[model samples]
Target chain A: MKRRWRQLIYLLTATAAALFMFLPAAAETPVEKGLAIAREADARDTGFRDSTVNLLMILRNRHGQESIRRMRIRTLEVEGDGDKILNIFDSPRDVRGTALLTYTHKFGDDDQWLYLPALKRVKRISSRNKSGSFMGSEFAYEDIASQEVEKYTYKWIRDEVYDGLECFVIERYPLDRKNSGYRRQMIWIDKKEYRTLKVDYYDRKDSLLKTLTLTGYRKYNNRFWRASGMNMVNHQNGKSTRLEFSDYRFGVGLRDSDFSRNSLKRVR
Target chain B: MGRPAYASAAVPLALVLLLVFFVSRSQACDLSGHASVEGRFFFRDALFPGQEGNSASVALQPEFYHGRRDGSGLTFTPFARFDSADPERSRFDIRELNYLMLGDHWELTVGISRVFWGVTEFVHLADIINQTDYVEDMDGEDKLGQPMIHLSMPRDWGVVDMFVLPYFRERTFPGEKGRLRTQPVVDTDRAVYESAAKEYHVDLALRYSHTAGIWDFGIYYFRGTGREPDFLLSADSSGKPVLVPFYVQIGQTGLDVQAVLGNWLFKLESIYRTSRDRNFFAGAGGFEYSMVNAASSGVDAGLIAEWAYDERGEDASTPFDNDVVLGIRLALNDAAGTEALIGISRDLDGGDSMLSLESGRRIGEAWKIALDAFFVIGSSEGDALHALRADDNVQVRLSYYF
Candidate 1:
């Protein structure tokens, strides 16, 4: 009789705790709603394992002079972490065999290594220069890095219609204010598929600096969404960069050993 | 540092063509490289008999490669240069002509290739795979292709690379007419060797490299004829003094390490060499700190400092017995990829000092411009850099890539 009474008390407490935690959806603040939405978007992107893509970057100045760069990128998703990436240049002839390997973390600085083809040597590089230009293009290193929701604090601004689709406009501020090039960013996320449609970057002076747009969304494995192209326009400088991606392959069976430092020298 | 014995490109032209024909039949053939035109101007008058003031050179290095993404590969790179002043600088080489076979856990390479090892910036104390191409660059950054059979295995603990070098390459030296040549010049034709096998001596090397967290390290052992030779003063047939290079058998072990923490990078390279003549330990250590977006500007700035030490002191074959180097690097985050680095080296024992500046910028899609200037601040006759005091020069190179 005594054991049965104790078990009844425990069951009653568990049910009460579950109800208290699940029944407060309407009472959530704007911050909580924004975080929830970010989490949902992140959850949808999980389980990709690995992916590879070939891309062409076209850079143009105000004078309309254009240049082109070709490269290949391989990425492996890590559980409870950021990602591991390998970037190899394929054009300009001078740096054709140069490669860069990066291991990003959800927190703290990323680990990066550069493989110099002429010397057949690898150099350990600092990733603190996230705001620096990448390959002389309009895209900053931070813009190309894997985005983790924990890097920023978000608040829901409002619901709006963008490009004939219902969207949620959220204001996000970088957690690393001292080092980030941007003061805040406004993100437009579509509601139906939870896809990021566009973003407006504000400089440290709280003024508009750059805008990025994603287009031609494609579904892979009938689950994951990927943008076929990206355009980044720098407002402060009259320069823009457009990235066209091709040959997207998912689940290529990549392992941690493939991202090792020794692998950098062999990525012909 | 293969000698100018390969006086003409015609020697290796047929061999390169034969390999190129065989590799392109399957798939993924790549043809690329760069052509450069360089001009060098000296600030002081010539100090030796064979005089020099200004020189110009044209160089071409073209690479042909064919490979499968996950299988074997064939690469051939031929280098040639034509100089207006120094005959020794007019040379030809096969920088890389190799066949690489890849397996699930190991890779093998057969033929000539370049191998670099070290982590320090100012000085390299642990790099011993390939001989230095001294005529190409006094900074010792350029290396001659070494003929070897290399095997590499990658495991969870570390990566192991073993090399069997069947042929020895002699270090190249500037000729009597070269601007940077010493007072008496080096007599390459009179080089001596302690080993009876001489240039045909076999060499063996093994290395293991690993990365743990933010640290990457390498350990290596080499047994062979030493790359850097001791000099024996001798008189030429014309009754002129000349330096005869004397190669000794040696065994060397090296270690290199690097650590990255935030914006700071620390590096170290050291070697302990034992030869029939003597034994010595040499080391180079340094640190670099980068400041991105300094003062709210897009330009990145980096501060670097390093120290090199050798147990032989003033009697060392190479300079840097005890020296310190300080440098600053600037990168402008622009479309043209503008960057520059200024450095200064000071000899702790002899008070010899020098300052150098190297800068480069990209032009459009397939062209680049590079500039380098060197100045000697102080030197004496007994110092190693004394021979270079009057050789202060500025060089400009324009490269076109395809």
Candidate 2:
């Protein structure tokens, strides 16, 4: 009777160990968890047909000298692909009336065109410089673009509390390793709204290069959440760029025709 | 004297009328302007007999717009420049004085404006709408605004633009005191027009542009007075050999295409021009590849190469016939907006070559400094640049915006 009881206990212990070993693999891996989180975040942000917003960009140097630039942005979200964005500068006098138009794709290279008011011409630009600073600002071109899910592969990091909000930390590695300047990026998303609160960018050398923090969340249309301010700080250069967004208008009924090159000349 | 007096009085009268119109619709009108002072100093001695060593200039451009959100608007941009070295270089232009109305799929614009069309970097073979304002710069980028009525219609396949240009303006020429000039001075007063209508000739242009994925393509057809004037050597009133500009009517078919792939951009501009004097084809094709954030230093560098060809070869008008150009561009991606470019063009026929360097950076908030250098080597007697071979020099320009 004693031997039979010991054998039953051993069988229970072995089964418990086996379940512990296979549970995480069968339920969810780190990659699966990360992708699921990203998918959820992206799904929540969809259905915004079009939006227009006014932006004020403040650039500060190491010496704390600041220069302000005012611009307006119009964006249209494509159902299955990426987004189309138009940025028009209004102030700083020298760059006034300059406009940049971009059409991003899900898989391949994006398209960009720049309109110079002084020249009264539109120039097609190469969009492979995703890591280059945008208009001499600390924000790289890739940073301002819509973050497509397929552009990067993800790994779920541990969760942590940031700014008194429970957040999930995820690390993403760019799929286009050769073109991207960043090796990986760590993103902190809040648990309640899945809104991105902070991001740490690592350069190709796997060194921390910049940190981007977003704050001042304002809900619009009772469904869409827009950040009022975004601050990017370069760790190596001690320079920073801050974007303050205001006057957001959504669902303006903008069509694909409005984003054509012909409209670029007619944009006010 | 009568014409000058009338012209001088007409400017102020028009200004007063515009001001009155804006003041009457104060709620819809917005006024903005910028004034700039520039100085150009030559590093070498004067190339021509009457040329100066340095010059100073001031320019004022004021833009006024009255419009609504629905794309109905009137815009007026009046530009004026005053140069100390050459009176011919100083002039006034209505860069854009147009009334635009936009509909669901069509747009109409009436009045004077500027239009540019091209894809290549070295030469703008497809750009023919506006006459080159040569006195403003040697790169042929500056243009004299054209008076026209334009209509554009966008369709699923492409966008079509039609232009009806009336009342042509004569091209301005540099004075004898200017540095870059031909051996014989150009006599603008003796300008000849092939059409009996002269400046009243009606010109027309049609263009179609489309973008498909990575490629952008455009085809344009223009039937009008040629912007480039044929030089006829004649005796001036001073009994000296002078070049008379003879404007001729011509038909031009132009094609411009650009393909963006990865970090490379390929551009091409080709044009076929037919006129009473001659029929010829010219083209420029180039490619540029950029290395983004080279070595992770926050700098971008682009390497460019282009080939320019003309059927007329040595008899071609400009210096870009059968030439190869290689250039490099550097962007410092800094707060000061620093950019530098260097290019060298080699003539395949005569071994003559030209090298150019341009660099610019902004200072403080509203100030900009630019440096430009041009050098020529081994310009044979039959080469087009032989006349200006000795004119190699550098110039420094400082400008204050607004």
Clashes of each: 0, 0
Q: Write the per-residue lDDT of candidate 1 for residues A158-261, one digit (tens) a residue.
A: 99999999999988888877778899889999999999999999998999999999999999888899998999999998899999998888999988867878
lDDT by residue (tens digit), candidate 2, B257-325: 999998999999999999997899999999999888888788989999999999989987789899999
Considering only chain B, report the TM-score of each candidate against the true chain B. Answer: 0.96, 0.93
Candidate 1 has a DockQ of 0.59
Give per-residue lDDT, candidate 1, residue A190.
97
Candidates' C-alpha lDDT = 0.87, 0.86
Please provide, for model 1 over B1-402, each residue's C-alpha lDDT reduced to its tens digit, 9 standing for 90 to 100: 235343344644565677767764755887789999999999999888886789999999998888877747788888999989888889888788888888788889987888889988768789999998888988788888887899999998989999999878788888888987777888888899999998789999999998888899999999999999888899888989988888999999999999988789999999999998799999999999999878867788899999999999988867688999999999886667689999999999899999899898889778999999988899987888888889999999999988
Model 2 chain B scores worst on lDDT over the 10 consecutive residues at: B1-10
**What pairs collide in candidate 1?**
none
Tell me the TM-score of each prediction against the true structure.
0.94, 0.94
DockQ of each candidate relative to the true complex: 0.59, 0.70
Clashes of 1: 0
Which parts of model 2 are misplaced by more than 4 Å? A1-26, B1-20
